[model samples]
Target: MAHIRERSLTHPVPELRGHGLLLRPWDAGSDAEVAEWLRGVSDPGFQQWNTPLNPVTDLAGARGSLRARAENAANGLSASFRVTDASSGRTLGHIGVNEIDRTFRVARVGYWTLPEARGRRVATRALVLAAHWALTGLGLHRLELGHALGHDASCHIAEQCGFRAEGTLRGAMFEAGRLDAFRDVHLHGRLATDPAVDLK
Candidate 1:
């Protein structure tokens, strides 16, 4: 047996193009940009599901938090990227791979699309690319995709991307505000080694 160094990797820092959608990592000093996007955006659907970043003390606080996680890839933590438009570079949403396990070859998939980005099948395309990257570039074995029990669009996106339902985890997550207790979430998952017979 030998100890192997986990390969240091960088997420796609490109203007990813898929089905007319683009995704890229956040840029330096994007705090105001990200924050302003959140300003006055009233969508309970987004808030209930994704916990829209709020109570932002200042631009510095927001940037420091997001950037610190990106800088922590040397560890097993997670990092997120901005889902945006290729031509105009407008922010559409967010996506990330969390619960990274190098030794175990596993990670959790998570994403949220802006209300404007929904109904366009944009998530399906972005997630397809994410799956391709996760299974091939990241060398992951299994990926978990979870969502609040009532979140249908999220579940649909996961299933459309080939992730299979794995039953709900009772009291799995904590809701925001008022110190809410664990809430049930529907669990879905997929494995990299799932049969490739269809590949031509």
Candidate 2:
């Protein structure tokens, strides 16, 4: 697998601008931002939608998470970005493309927003920017977005970002519930050939 640093040494991760948001590489020096991200992930709402996951309990865990993200990006396995407020530069959320299959020109996208960022279409805009880059900048042919069944907000975001509903995978994911049971997943995808929808 080609590392993102190798690709970035040639073609760096582009700055993606959106309405009221800016998607950029995660900053390694921003302890406050990292802490905020940990808080967001710790939110019950966020945990509910994105679960069966380890929680970042403290500064050390947060640093470990950021380090892992950087290493993944450096190795080309994934590209992660921090979604920030355009004006104040407050960290609002995160979005990333993972499971990148260079041979197949495909990847899976995921995101999470802080409680204060909810209902603002922050994730939707970030998704558009990331997907656009994946399709054009990365020259990927296909992109996939999946969410646990019943997560209507995620489904709406995927649809608004031009991904078409594909199908459902039964017991495809696990959520951090009482028993950590597997849950059905709703899949959506977009092809590079798909017409771009006006997000304005």
Candidate 3:
């Protein structure tokens, strides 16, 4: 597989409308918003969307995470972004495509919206935008999203975006609080060829 890192894509801010949201790259410096958003996330199920970086309880930690994200992008691994209100541009959530494989044109997509952002069709719009960018702008063939089976909301988002449910993983995650963290996630995905998948 040719490494996706070799593709060297310039992250583009994608525009998605019709569902009252916009999906775009995280601003050059958005640590404050990142930290504040993380703090506001009080649900354990939603928090699983992030990697197991040490918990960020302060702005400094969020800054550190942003720095690390830049480093990762430089190394050819991930690209992250924020989901916002199209009209107001208020940061409502964050999402990203990670573990990119250029040869296969595959990447793992993940995201979570604020509690206030939930049930507003924000995630659905953001995810579709990400997929559109991946399959067209980035020339990717496959996009995958995995969510703990228990997190029905996330799974629902993936499905609503036209990703077909694949299967479940077992004992693949360790969540916060030693709470029997197992990945056991249901995988949802689409290939660029699927007519329903927005490969535009």
Per-model root-mean-square deviation over C-alphas: 6.0, 4.0, 5.4
Against the true structure, what is each candidate's TM-score? 0.78, 0.90, 0.80
**Candidate 1 accuracy as lDDT:** 0.65
Best by TM-score: 2
Query: What is model 2's C-alpha RMSD?
Result: 4.0
In candidate 1, what are the lDDT values of residues 1-200, reduced to their tens digit?
11122223444333345555566665546665557335313355555765433433555656665666566543546545577665687777767777778789888978767777778766666676666666766788998998989888888888877889999999777674324566789999889977431211
As a whole number from 0 to 100, the lDDT of residue 107 in candidate 1 is: 87
Model 1 misplacement above 4 A = 1-15, 36-43, 51-58, 74-76, 176-178, 195-200
What TM-score would you give candidate 1 relative to the actual structure?
0.78
lDDT of each: 0.65, 0.82, 0.68
| lDDT (Cα, tens digit) per residue for candidate 3, span 1-200 | 01112222354333444356666555437665766555544455465554464665666666677667666666657777677786898888877888888888899988877777777777777777777767776788999888766888887788888889988877666654455454566888878887654422
By descending lDDT, how would the candidates be arranged? 2, 3, 1
Q: Candidates 2 and 3: which is better by lDDT?
A: 2
Q: Give residue 16's lDDT in candidate 3 (0 to 100).
A: 42
Q: Best to worst by TM-score, what's the order?
A: 2, 3, 1
Worst 10 residues of 2 by lDDT: 1-10
Residue runs of model 3 more than 4 Å from their true location after superposition: 1-18, 28-31, 40-45, 48-51, 179-183, 197-200
